[model samples]
Target: MATSVLSKSVLPKVPKTARKTSTKTAALQAQPDAHEPDANKTLNLILSRLDDMKAEETVTIDLRGKSAYSDYMIITSGRANRHVGAIAENVTKGLKESGVKSVHVEGLPNCDWVLIDSGDVIVHVFRPEVREFYNLERLWTQNPAVAAV
Candidate 1:
């Protein structure tokens, strides 16, 4: 009986230059470019969308130092469930159109309190009563030094 052995020559090798190029491309892609909007821009876009959708009692809390989850936390009130749903939808669309690759949304079915997590910003669109009950503004703005818009 004869045993067959495989040789290194049978395997295809990737070129060193190709590997280097791929590494460099991945690194470049990982870094945010000038075209990408910063946290402030994203916050502004969200605020504008909320305003366009007629969200009420809009409050923006700067959560940069306080929370690692998001740079800004926006709490706004909608007249009712439908309004809350609309506000969240508009924000999601606006953020996506502005080049946000992923925008996570929750609580859309009931719309009691819709949460839109757009990387740099977190938006909560709630019914007026729900917003009052949660009182996220008071909870988040314990420190008056943090700017609120």
Candidate 2:
């Protein structure tokens, strides 16, 4: 006789372990949020996650009239390559958990700079030297026409 296809041995077992929230995240949740409007909920979530990860020199640019792609662009520097990757991953995870779908990400393997694009926001995580070399904030904030290029 042939073995049963629906046998218990053929099925994968799943563990029922309880999940614990991280101390950092719990602490952040306890703090009162400086209320931004409903339109900026996603933006606030990303910013908080970046803060939790210790991302530095964070700059937020209002791209409301400037770019059709997203309403906001956030540029932040991580201490190093690993930090950049971690920051990007954290932001992406947060976006997904917040029910934002179709988030796009790039540059994770290189880790010198990582870009996360949600529909409403774009985030750049870079190493200090890499951020200085690109100077993306200057392009976007200083000259609108130049940023288009």
Candidate 3:
């Protein structure tokens, strides 16, 4: 009978050839998980990773009182589809490693845009053109664009 989860997690491989048993044991036990990280820690981690990935035109819109979905929304651009996917991948990886639970990802296949939802923070990695078209920052912001008379 199959478990409720569709897929099973693959354990990290232990090198049978390794001379030291202690090293192998350490490697297996290194994967320690903690409770969900605080909001500031989570936000800082995401920002740092984006910077490391050289994401362009990054914008952080504070949605604290505005939205219940997440406390912060980070919007950034990648040079191309591949870069976008890479940025999304890095963000998700960092979140998981830091013990953020149940991170949800979408639009990875197309890579034109990827949304990573980590409960506390929402990050959007997009290609330059797609970002301009969607303009999520404008939609979320309280101030409306003033029309010329």
TM-score of every candidate: 0.79, 0.72, 0.72
What is candidate 1's local distance difference test score? 0.85
**lDDT for predicted candidate 3 compared with the true structure:** 0.88
- The predicted structure with the larger TM-score, 1 or 2, is 1
Q: Which residue ranges in model 2 land beyond 4 Å of their true spot?
A: 1-39
Candidate 1 on 27-77: residue-level lDDT in tens? 888887656678999998998898898899889888877876789889998
lDDT of each: 0.85, 0.86, 0.88
lDDT of 2 by residue, 47-134 (tens): 9999999999999998888887789999999998988999999999988887786789999999998989887899999999989999
Give the Å shift of residue 87 in candidate 2.
Answer: 0.7
The candidate scoring highest on lDDT is 3
Q: Lowest-scoring 10 consecutive residues by lDDT in candidate 1?
A: 1-10
Tell me how many residue pairs clash in candidate 3.
Answer: 0
Look at candidate 1 and tell me the lDDT of residue 60: 88
Give residue 139's lDDT in candidate 1 (0 to 100): 73
lDDT of 3 by residue, 29-99 (tens): 78655577978899999999999999999999887766667889899999999999999999999999999
- Give candidate 1 regions above 4 Å deviation: 1-4, 7-23, 33-35, 143-149
Highest TM-score model number:
1
